[model samples]
Target: MADTVFFVTKASGKQEAFDLGKLQHSLKRAGAPPSAMPEIEEAVQKMLYPGISTREIYRKAFSLLRKASPHMAARYKLKKAIMELGPSGFPFEKYVGKLLDFEGYDTQVGKIVQGHCVPHEIDVIALKDEQHFMIECKYHSEQNRKCDVKIPLYIHARFLDVEKMWQQRPGHDHKFHQGWIVTNTRFTDAAIQYGNCAGLRLISWNYPRKESLKKRIDRSGLHPLTCLTTLTKKEKQQLLDQGLVLCRELHRDLNQLRSVGVSEARLKKVEQEVRLLCEPESPIL
Candidate 1:
């Protein structure tokens, strides 16, 4: 094995040697078939070159995986595919609400409520078993950017104002309220520290290491519609605009796809992929 060694440029602009083992591990996590690994690896080797962006590598790998298993390819691309949820954070907020819904929570998105000091536009509000969570969803279009300390600080302040209002209103208990900040990307170290110190629930792509946002979503089998490879951009947007944010929602209602002009053949393919992607799995983290 005397092939040229290759390096990959990461989203952080850092470079590292490409490792076959790492790729294999990710493929396995994505539920790719064991029989297809060797072929995918060979293809990746043929595509590797010095200074290649990891994004390019991922795109190449996804293309190959789609041929063998569309479900696996979509799952493998989950992290990046989520970024396509919006030009704004609203879509991500709705998607998060849907995930919470899957977890047996009553969810509300984009609601405005009056605080003691000011009116706050909440991103997602999840209520279950008498506990309420006011979630602030921070969505970044670029992978390299992060949710910083200031975001949690702002969220905490708003939550506090709302809490004060609740306290002032006789018979309204404050113990039921909790503040959470969730992001599509990781958070800065200071942000995590502040969140922990302030008792705010912070969920990000890889933060809270073991119980990260990705792991939670995967465990709940609540992937966003963007994770499907079967839908075109127009089709996805149509569904998103219609508030069908989760794959499970789309899967449960095939007529929604048909109503949006998705062809019968493509609708069947999408349904199959959605079914596999949302299959019940053992708890993660």
Candidate 2:
């Protein structure tokens, strides 16, 4: 007798054979302990059924992971956490700036720069040494949505206009470097192709192979406050409202948690998770 295969529905509404290996890989990336994998895998397998949505599977695994390790569960939810950064793109733009700032770049979020033809509001501008990057952050609350070719096409034209003006500046002629599109989701193949051909650096959740946004966050220990399973939705929003985005920020100052009405008893649990999530790791790119 042959084994029956289960199909899983992706966020894009496409169906694919459920691959346990992918789940294992995700858990590993979340820094799940090897000892805990068997139980997670077994439990996940038991819950499998035809046409089950990937989001459902993730929640199940996340629940198990949260039980095993809150910090690891936080890491696993990084992508979703990023989406929670926005109903508006402004917070996401600022979050992108914070990531760049962590890498020793001088960054400005929501900066308006003069173009040769007009003024453009750059999402995030990262300056280091001679490299100047005009970054556009595409924030999507829905996982299925993607940054298509039009995004790069539009950003590239804006970049050219800005670069034209930048080159006429005394020191910026050679300083203005590349344009970037950073998103909390994936990019279409056509988008990636156009970006490469046009010399625009594109970054999505898991694109660019080894140098993706996920990899950057993992290495930098810059997990967002929304990743914490310990915090309620309201509490996370309150912290974000106060411009407290990074886990490291909360780890540094517990007063923010207190301000959000977190009790002294619960503060300890939140602090422990933040500390674990923000532990120093590999150097950022």
Best model number under TM-score: 2
lDDT (10s digit) by residue, model 2, range 202-279: 999988879899887876788889999999999999888888788888988999999999999999999999998888
**Mind sharing the TM-score for model 2?**
0.95
lDDT of each: 0.86, 0.90
lDDT of 1 at 190: 96
What lDDT does candidate 1 reach at residue 28? Answer: 84
Candidate with top lDDT is 2
On residues 1-285, what C-alpha lDDT tens digit does candidate 1 reach at each position?
346678899998999989988898788878888899889988888888889998988888899999999998988988987898988767899988878887899999999988988999999888888687789999998999998889999999999988788667655574478899999998999999999999999999977777788877777778888999998989888888888788888778788889889888777788899898878755533
CA RMSD per model (angstroms): 2.0, 2.0
| TM-scores, each model vs. reference | 0.92, 0.95
